[model samples]
Target: MTIDALRHSPEQLRARIAAELERARNRSTGLTDAVDGDDLVRQHSPLMSPLVWDYAHIGSQEELWLVRDVGGREPVRPDIDNIYDAFQTKRADRPSLPMLNPDEARVYVSTVRDKALDVLEHTPLEGRRLVEAGFAFGMIVQHEQQHVETMLATHQLRQGPAVLDAPAPPPGAPAAETEVYVPGGMFLMGTDLDPWALDNERPAHAVGVEPYWIDTDPVTNAQYAQFIADGGYADRRWWTPEGWAHRSNAELTAPQFWHDDGTRTRFGHVEPIPPDEPVQHVCWYEADAYARWAGKRLPTEAEWEMAARYDPESGRSLRYPWGDEDPTDEHANLGGRYLQPAPVGAFPKGTSPLGVRGLVGDVWEWTSSDFTPYPGFAMFPYPEYSEVFFGPDYKILRGGSWAADPAAVRATFRNWDYPIRRQIFSGFRCARDV
Candidate 1:
């Protein structure tokens, strides 16, 4: 529930990992039951793998890390390594590959988990490479949760009656003030103290940012509709050269899952757009164009962190907007308790010291900064996790989303994707110069 939980003893860490693994399996199982086995193998989108492949890969990855790497044990099934290797196999070719069917995947994951638990029970939790502070366990849990989010995205892209459901987020009042002015100052920008932080967020450093104004909450459907009505997408000046080219190539008129009938799609169901809810499924290009049309700009990653973490009064950055405590229902709409974004300004209780609302969850807010490493950044447990993707090509997204796990959401957490990616639960708010 807190950072303390992540840094706890071997027994506590084992229990937390077990619970999280179960949670991830429950989500995957629910999606699997919603359709037939054929649906599981059918590629919903070329960007993502088949549902069955994700199911088995989750097990394979667990075995690779917890069972084999940290536990110093032999591989459970070395032959399946190449099949589930994400870097080796392209997504479009996954269905043709020799992947385990749904039943076999389920059984394999169950067996792998059983063996991993036995290893956890006996392994020491201190003074080791991966086992120190239960790093491998936490990493494996987070990895599974990340895949759970990916599988949920596959559900959103698939077409049919709604296979998943959750209650709507709490209503929100119209955003007050419209923008919060963040003072220009040097602020600590990443996590050095949190043991569970990923490699990209390590080696916290001080960053100097100019004073800027940020939206009080995420941009809403009503606001984005104005951009669409104004022919924002038709105009090339508002988009970056690359963004424009991508948009033109894809013929993107609006967010990926939105329909032409004034309704938005979620988990294969269509419903009228909730004017108050934060606009989601928007890519960096659309978000950028919307900001330009509104006479604003996307906040730089440094500026975004300054607003979310700096406390003028306390003179120290807090772990979350509401301080060093785990998120509660009052704080944010998270853990997929709701299937959609909470309306802008919904979680006022979660506002930062400068009164920025909905800073932690509901949607992953796209910042203007490129994905890059901090000063003194070093590869922690592996190179493939974050080091492989650092560059100007990928944009950074701060904050967690509705589907994000509680333990994995932190102020220093970093998420990145290609700027054109819109299928993930992504949205943005506008920022402006002072």
Candidate 2:
């Protein structure tokens, strides 16, 4: 079916949903299958779960939402639901749980997927909010894809030979300017019409922003290296008191995985740091300190969104930086096509109307904004997805990374984490007052 047909026809929507479900499963299995049973069952790091847990948890979520809730079908594995409950179980403790083993997890997920597809066939696409426009299926697709990204991060942290491989990203183009000026004005900041946008990104509202200058592309490794060379990490003036305390306690002198000799680990291979690629694995504190050392600051969430989605002449926010259309390989480096971020300024086609580039793919850009609900926000489907995490304790990150799936990210999508986290694929650009 044509991509557009899925929006109007029930049969086409079901087909699209099935394709997405299968695609997510392929990525999940590919990551797990590359390693042995021990690797799958062992927790690579305390920050993430055992690969086997994620595998079975994905199946449990599908069964809970699609089979039991949406399809009114009997439970496939009611006995292990609590063991896989993310909110109830912590990552550090999941390895000790009596979760399914690698072999059993594979079978459990396969059975759940078959039942989910059956539900998709019988359930009407209209009526309730969850199933409307195939939102539930879309949510599940996004959920699985998110876990895939998390699994990729765990793989990065694994201590051993690299088992993953992918072609290098395309070379970058020369940027005409270092920074682009965004005029002060009002723009719609979130989504109201997007069927799959999570609760935090809903009820689009107008936000008034002031004129500012934002980097045309994300800050590059070479530029960040300058900050390190200038003793940015040791200089107390560059970091907030909280940031300085964490940096001192953790002894963080460079981005995670960097060696004092100027080489860094990528996947598992040691190589010279790519000067042109966007810096990855940086915490918000590090990004903020680097920005301060450069006499700039991280962009606020509103400013970042404005630069990414607003078109001054049209006075409308496009669904993505380039335009109101879904992402493709040419537009952004996404869907694990490349294991690492494309070089800054690589995807000219993905540039926003204001000439800001690389806003959608490469790394999750840290913003100064705290994670909070938008005006008129309401809980939907479940509150655990977003509501429970809303507050200043979490900082916001925008855009998608190379590991992120296209279905899981958009201009309006929101990701949040503690400010001290550096394991995720993250980076940032700078902005300044005009």
TM-scores across all candidates? Answer: 0.97, 0.98
Q: Write the per-residue lDDT of candidate 1 for residues 1-434, one digit (tens) a residue.
A: 46686557667877776686777678767767777898898998999899999989989999999889877788888999999999899999999999998888889988898888888888887888577667787788788888878888998888777768888788888766889988788888897777677889888888898889999989998889889998999999899998899999999998877788999777777789988888889999899989998999999988888888899898888889988887889998888888888887778889999889888898899999999999998998878889999999999998989988776788888999999999999998889999
* Alpha-carbon runs more than 4 Å astray in model 1: 6-10
Per-candidate RMSD, Å: 1.5, 1.3
Query: lDDT for every model?
Result: 0.86, 0.92
The regions of model 2 sitting more than 4 angstroms off are 1-6
State model 1's lDDT.
Answer: 0.86
Cα lDDT tens digits, model 2, 138-171, are 9999999999999999999998888999988899
Model 1: C-alpha RMSD to truth? 1.5
The TM-score of candidate 1 is: 0.97
